[model samples]
Target: MVLAGRLRVYLIALWIVGSGSNIVNAAGPVAETSTATIVENVSYQNITALPWREADHRFNYGPQSLQFGGLWLPESASADNPAPLVIFVHGGCWLSAYDIRHSYPLSTALADSGFAVWSIEYRRSGDPGGGWPGSLEDVIAGISHIRQLQDFSVDLERVVLTGHSAGGHLALLAAQHNDLPSLDAVVGLAAITDISEYALGDNGCQKAAAGFMGGSSLQAPAAYEQAQISVDKLPSTVSLLHGEQDSIVPLTQSDGFEHHRLPRAGHFDWLHPQTPAYRLLINRLEHYLPEHTP
Candidate 1:
């Protein structure tokens, strides 16, 4: 734990220096207080192609044209019923090669279970912080877009955020910054929460992760330190889900995070299922989200 903290400090310094050239372009603005930071007059659409015909939503925010679109599934059992909302984030180690499609099954399942779902895509580094703070910024921008759609069958207060793999990290960041009345809970599925552990992977995965992060802990300390994805800053009701046998992102990251901060955890739940991690993720989610209950 001490090593992690020390490493975090070192990484933070590197994040500041190595990422100095890009920090201004990363997160558009430092959130003074967690509020629904909106990026308006933007377009949201079905940008996915071919066999899947998935929707990839986009919106213009700050300097960059934020991509990694979204698929919004609205509640349809009745018109008057404003259903709960769940935002799904796709994980691809924050690389360009991976997009939101990987999470379609989970998104669709949640939506079919009666929740208004938003499966989101965001810019990735193809290596580390996954485009520095751009990935994080995109998350903020996407949720803000959804929040503005008041006429939609979305219940702001009951909003839930979930993501798998690298996306799990992004989802945690979103939930932490979501001080909005609509925000409810956050769920991470086999998340690479402890990014410093990228050294544990094979050469390819290691290169992909480190390259995305902009180098190793010794090289890009600032980015790692600036990375707010860890449990050190997680929200009150955060849930960390890990596959007991997960080889991609070891269950140890989740365990380490919980070990570091166990007291502040009021509503936090960490469960490794005898079943798939996804089932456990959904099960925990169902208990908190009313729409998913029955």
Candidate 2:
């Protein structure tokens, strides 16, 4: 287990840079952060610096211009032996400022690690058909459309939905609806669960929550109520992961939910494959969906 785990770090680091960065203590289970440190930082730019692969194919799920997804398949994937799917949704404070390109590295890394990945692109708060429930509707439609795609080699039975930041908020909301397609689990990475509370925060990302909702919690109480999510209502199968050092979405955003908190990780750490936080994410995926066999 140590050998395989350490090898992944080498492979991903080599791809990021000929850096060959090695994790010092990569044996046995990941160290238990029995009493983890909780920090806060504002810098968020790691994955943006790395070279990432483009998706193998792009498919549109709806007539709207922004409703589409990029599909990445592992080299070993074939019609006879399909790979389990990980549907990725990105976060840009629910705005069009941050698109799906930044997440390519994540999808690419996951594909290289032997899973089929689909990084979804949806209309954002700034777009015509985006904002509020519409952005979420697109995510639901995009996930459901995977059932109709005839080109990809994926095991629909072994699927997981995961999103970051605003996208994570959408994923969690979609999971609550009965219409969403079947999934092994739903993962929220630094998700903003309480719209009203988050809007009160000072960060740019936190302030943008109102724009996505079209008004402040007090201005649009109904919208905030409709969008709010509580841990008590979520299924045990849904997993939450957050970086205690996250600057954008506070770790308190994950409060009430059973989660894995990476003490040393920051917000963007989840996107960079080389970070220990990313390792925990991979471990979570493996726990939820193992390799598919023909």
* Best by the lDDT measure: 2
* Per-candidate local distance difference test: 0.53, 0.77
**Runs of candidate 2 exceeding 4 Å displacement:** 1-43, 292-294
Candidate 1, residue 23: the lDDT equals 16
lDDT of 1: 0.53
Candidate 1 lDDT over 94-193, as tens digits, reads: 7675556534434444555566677776778752334767788777777666766466666666778777767777777676674533567777766666
Q: Give the Cα-based TM-score of candidate 1 against the true structure.
A: 0.67
Off by over 4 Å in 1: 1-68, 74-77, 126-130, 178-182, 228-232, 257-276, 291-294
Worst 10 residues of 2 by lDDT: 2-11
RMSD of 1: 15.3
lDDT of model 1 at position 22:
18
Count of clashing residue pairs in every prediction? 25, 0
User: TM-scores, in order shown?
Assistant: 0.67, 0.84
lDDT of 2 by residue, 1-294 (tens): 111121111112111111223323221222221113322332344455444566888989999889999998888788988888899999878888667876876787788777889888999978998998899999988888888655668888888999998889988887787777788999998888888999998777887889999999889999999999866566568888998887778888888887888887888777766677777888999989976445
